[model samples]
Target: MNIPFYKMHGIGNDFVVIDNSVNSISLNKRRVKALCDRRYGIGCDQLIVLSNPKNDLADVYVQFFNGNGDEAGACGNGSRCVIAWLYRKYHRTEFILQTNAGLLPAQVIDSQMVKVNMGQPRTKWRDIPLKHEADTLYLPLAGEPSAVSIGNPHVTFFVEDLSTVDPVFCGKVLEKDPLFVEGANISFVQMLDRQAMRVRVWERGSGLTLACGSGACASVVNAVRRGLADRHCQVKMDGGNLIIDWDAENNEVLMTGPTSFSYQGSFDLDHYPL
Candidate 1:
C-alpha cells in the first residue's frame, strides 16, 4: 500500500490521516480496523480520510472512522487534524472543510491552538432520531438523559458523582438500544463548578476515547437545560478540556480546542502494520 499518513491530535485525541485526494488510498473495514490497532497498525485512536469534495461544494471532504472501522458522521478532533494538515500544506492559518455531517470552518488560533466552528445543533426529536419523538431538546428519556444532535446523536446524563457513573458500561448499552437506530455517543457529565464540568463519553463505534468534542457540546446543552450551569462552560474530558458555548439566537453550539501534529509516515499496502 505504501500509503502516506499524518498523525494529528486535538486535546490529546489523535488520528492518522490519509490524503485520499492525492493517494487513492483505500482500505476495507478489516484493514482500517487493523491500522487503528495500537499494537498492529499506525496506532491512532481513529483514522481520518481526507478526499476531494464529492459535490464540489467545499474544498475537501472528510471521512472519520473509529479504531473498529465504523464510519462516524462527525469528529471534531479529527476535523482539527484535517484542517491543520491542510494549513501545513498551504502555510495558511484558516480554512473551510466539509464532513459527512456538514461544512466546518477552522483556523489556527495560536501557534499550537486551533478553533473550529462546528455549526449549529438540531434538537428536534427526529433530528436526534430517538424513536417515538417527545422533545429531545430536553428529552426526558426513561433514564433522564438530555438529547441533542450536533452532527451526531448524543444523550448526556448529568451525574452527581463523575466517578460513580461507569461510562463504558452505560454507554455500551445505550449505543445499541433501538432508541438510537444509528447508535450514539453517550456522555456522563458532572458539573465541577459554575464554569466547568467533568465528562466521560462512550462514543459510537469507537467506544471510549480520551475525548469526544460533540459529547462536550451535548453535555453543556444538557447541563444548561437542567440549570446545572450557564450557557458557556468548560468541559474537562479524560484527555483534556474543551470550551463550549450555546448561541440561542443562532441555535448553534460552538466548541473550541487545540489540535496537535505528531508524525508523518507511510505503510505498506500488502499488510496492515502497526
Candidate 2:
C-alpha cells in the first residue's frame, strides 16, 4: 500500500504526518522507525498519525511516534502541525484533537500561525512519575533540574549561559536517569530577562531537535515556579521563538508558534517491514 503523507513543521521541529482517518494503514515499530530514518526513509523528528476521533468532541485523534518508533503521549510542536494540517484540509479555524495524553484544544491564528492549549503542567512527582517521591521543583540531580509534565515528562535546567552547557551530553545522560521512571526530555534554559529566555532541548526520543514545544512549556512553568520568569514569556529555541503563556486563572498553558508546510508525498508500505 502506498501511504500519502504531509511534511510539516512548527518552528523547526518537523514531522511526517499521515492521515489515517480511514483506518486503512497499519503501523508497527519497525515501519515507524524505518519511516523516520533520514538515510533510509522520509526522515522527520517524529511521525504523526491522524485517525478518526473516538471522542465526540474531538475532530481527530492524533498519535505521535518518536524517531525511535516509541509512542509519545504528547508533542506540542507536532500538535500544532496536526492542527494546521486539519485546518488546511477542513478549512476550519478551531479544532479539538484527542491524543494518548488527553484532549487538546487548538485554533489557527492565521495561515501559518497556530495556538494550542497544552492543558495544565503536572508538577507532582507521581505525575511526572519519578522513581520515587521527590521535590518536582528541585530534583536531586546534577543540575538540580525541575520536572514538569505537559502530557509528557520534561526536566528543565536553568543555566546562566546556554553556551556553557552541552545539551547533547546532558540530555543523553539525564534522559535515562534512574530518577525518571520513564525517560524525560531535557531542556537547558538561559533566561535573558523576565519575559524572554533561550532554550535548548534534548528531546526524549528524537534527540537534539531544532525546537521542542513541550520542553518550552515545561521550562517556562519551572521558571515561573522558581519565580525566575513571569506567566507569559518568549521561549527562544534554535529553530525559532514560541510564545508560552501559563494562564494562572485557567491553569492552562498556551503555546503559540508558526508552522510550515514542507511538501506532500507518498511511500510504499511494502518497502518497510512490519
Candidate 3:
C-alpha cells in the first residue's frame, strides 16, 4: 500500500506525519521504527499519525511514535506541527488535539508559527511515576535534577555552563536511570538570565534531537519551581528558541514556536515489513 506522508518540523524536531483518518493505516512496531530510520526510511525524530478524534471535544486524534517505535504520551513541538497540518486542511486557527496525554488546545499564530497549551505539569513522584517516592523538586541524583511529567517523564538539570556538559553522554546515562521506571527525557539547562536559558535534550526513545518541546516546557517549569527563572521564559535549543509560559492561574504550560513544512511524499508500505 502506498501511504501519503507530510514532512513537518517545529523548530528542528522533525516528524513524518500521516493522515490515518480515512486510510487507517496499520503501523506495527517494525514499520514505525523503519519509517523513522534515518538511513533506510523517511527519517524523523518522531512519527505522527492523525486519525478521527475519539473524543467528542477534540478536532482530531494524534498519536506519536518515537524513532525507536515506542508510543509516547505527548510531544509539545509535534502537537504544534499537527496543528499546522490541520490548519492547511481546515483553514481554521483553533483546534483540539486528543493524545494519550489528554486533550490539548492549539492555535495557529501564523503560516509558520503555532502555540499549544501543553496542559499541566505533574510534579509528584508518583505522577512522574518514578520507581519510588522521591522529591520531584529535587531528585537524589548527582546533579540533583528536578522531575516533571509533561504528558511524558522529563528530568531537568540546571548546569552552570552548557558548553562543559555533553548532552549525549549525560542523556544516555540518565535517561534510563533506575529512578525513572518508564525512562525519561533528559535535559541539561544553562541559565542565561532570569528570563532566558539554553537547553540540550536527550529525548527518550529518539536519542538526541535538534529540539525537544516538552523538555523545554519541563525545563521552564522546573526553573520556576526552583526560583531560577521567571514563569514566562525563553528556552534556547540547538534548533532555535521557544517561549514557554507557566500560567499559574490556569495551572497550564503554553509553548510557542515556529513550524515548517519540509516537503510531502508517499512511500510503499511493502518496503517495511510488519
lDDT of 1 by residue, 171-194 (tens): 899888787867888888888987
Q: TM-score for model 2?
A: 0.99
Residue 32's lDDT within candidate 2 is 94
TM-score, structure 1 vs. true: 0.93
Candidate 2 on 163-209: residue-level lDDT in tens? Answer: 99998988899889999888999999999999999999999988999
RMSD of 1: 2.0
Error of 3 at 79 (Å): 0.3
By lDDT, the best candidate is 3
As for candidate 1, its clashing pairs are 1-269, 40-274, 41-273, 41-274
The C-alpha local distance difference test score for the whole of candidate 1 amounts to 0.82
lDDT of 3 by residue, 71-174 (tens): 99999999999999999999999999999999999999999889999999999999898999999999999989999999999999999999999889888889
Q: Candidates' lDDT values, in order?
A: 0.82, 0.94, 0.95
**TM-scores, one per candidate:** 0.93, 0.99, 0.99
Best of the two (1, 2) by TM-score: 2
